[model samples]
Target: MGERSDGDVVLAACDLVVAGIDGPGVSALAGVSLRRPWDEIQPLLGDALLELGLDHHEHNSNEGKALGLRLMARRTLAGELSARELAAWVHDRFGHGLPAAEELARLDDEYDILEYDDRATTDVDEQVMAEVRRITS
Candidate 1:
């Protein structure tokens, strides 16, 4: 669900794999819902995959990448955040198994808004709102 494999794939193909995994739903935009914390999320994946009878190894990579990005984004935004930080946040979220440089490059290639500009001011709240709009709509 996190990895943008293409434009059309919204959720993971493995239905059983995500069964019981508390993730972001449509209500995420309303800011009234809670999602599985990373600490809770990381451990459950193994069991979920096992229960689903799927290859845990194949999916674990993207899970880790997505978790790392979420962590980084939370930390960066909690402090002085910028567009570069936002881009880095998105890169880490989507990068998955790709190299760091490659991940950043992919972000650059995919979206014009992720570009880091020194001229821009850092505003975590505003940037987050912008990001939410960008991703959701």
Candidate 2:
């Protein structure tokens, strides 16, 4: 996590769907321990932005709204890095469509956050996990 002089760094992964894949699209914030120095994670953020296969075309379907990575870095009192600063950085980097990530809540299972909000959340996750296991096995 990018610990800013601010506080605990929080990250929400961008929803990913392989462009032409008909089944088993992947989505979730797989847990990661980002204990690297800010200098390291900073540039890595750019690389992550580049890897999001989202389509931004106005004519694109609902997927066009998929966000790039939400970088959550806490700034220290030395004030070298702060969450407030990350807000502006996120906007400038990912465009206005992306949220500043200022209001995210913590969750124990957040790494498995589902993209779907409907009643099928459990079903979707189970199906995807099953598909993954089947392929990998």
Candidate 3:
């Protein structure tokens, strides 16, 4: 493939996150700043993450949690959702408090300089990339 556009990088990073990869892994895979807030980025990383979560939930057999995730994902993509709204939903569902402040700080602190690897794209990456292309197109 040629050089990845910004949208491609954001989509790939979102896919990596949904595939059980975290900040560092996504940064390495996409060679970009995954630590930046989604709102700050052009493609909106948070929206992509939520969308992928919804897709994952739909394809898997998990029903209860998947339903909730799909709802939140839809709300997010519709631009009708907020972090506080998601936090409230999580709290209501799981009865657990959200550490918003700490998590925000952690997000900022998670940046790392990763060496690029041409062979980084696995079979799953290709599948996710195809899905991303279909969605974005």
Candidate 4:
């Protein structure tokens, strides 16, 4: 793929964001970092993390709790299951909380602009380069 203007920064910071946000890209970016030139990548990473965190808090807040209870009540009334069972089921199926749409939007923005060029550097290439350098020396 063609190089992206912000590819390095995105690649560098993706790992932290993924670990926090539980997104699909998490696995692809397991160990990225914002070292050196990638330091500028922190703003994007921080924005995403902060947004996701806030969304999680909101999703688990008092209002959210009430909504969940209400939903469980309706389910119980319909003879679906007991309140406790419903709660447990919801928790397991939908997670304890959710990220906000704004946070998700920010993530989308970052991902859209990200440059994925030169993502994989094989050890074979490293070995070859080293061997070539040794021969030249």
Among these predictions, the greatest TM-score belongs to: 1
5 Cα displacement, candidate 3 (Å): 44
Per-model TM values vs. the true structure? 0.29, 0.19, 0.24, 0.22
The C-alpha local distance difference test score for the whole of candidate 1 amounts to 0.43
In model 4, how large is the Cα lDDT of residue 108? 30
State which candidate, 2 or 3, has the greater lDDT.
3
Query: Which residue window of length 10 is worst by lDDT in model 1?
Result: 25-34
The per-candidate count of clashes, in order, stands at 0, 12, 0, 0
Model 3 spans > 4 angstroms off? 1-62, 96-137
lDDT of 2 at 56: 31
Q: In order, what lDDT does every prediction score?
A: 0.43, 0.32, 0.42, 0.40
Cα RMSD for candidates in order: 13.3, 18.1, 20.3, 26.0
How well does candidate 4 match the true structure in TM-score terms?
Answer: 0.22
Q: Which 10 consecutive positions of candidate 2 have the poorest summed lDDT? A: 102-111
**Residue 85 local lDDT, model 3:** 48
Off by over 4 Å in 1: 1-60, 89-129, 132-137
**lDDT by residue for model 4 over 35-112, one digit each (tens)?**
543444333444444544532224246555444444444555566764334433444434444331222223333333
RMSD (CA, Å), candidate 4 to true, equals 26.0
Report the lDDT tens digits of candidate 2 across residue range 1-137. Answer: 11232112213332233332222222222122445333343334333434455433332222332232221232212345342343344344444443333222111122235444443444533443332233223
Over 1-137, each residue of candidate 3 has an lDDT whose tens digit, in order, gives 11245556766776776777665535444444546533354344445445446332232234535454445545544557543444334445434322322322222222211123333324323433332233334
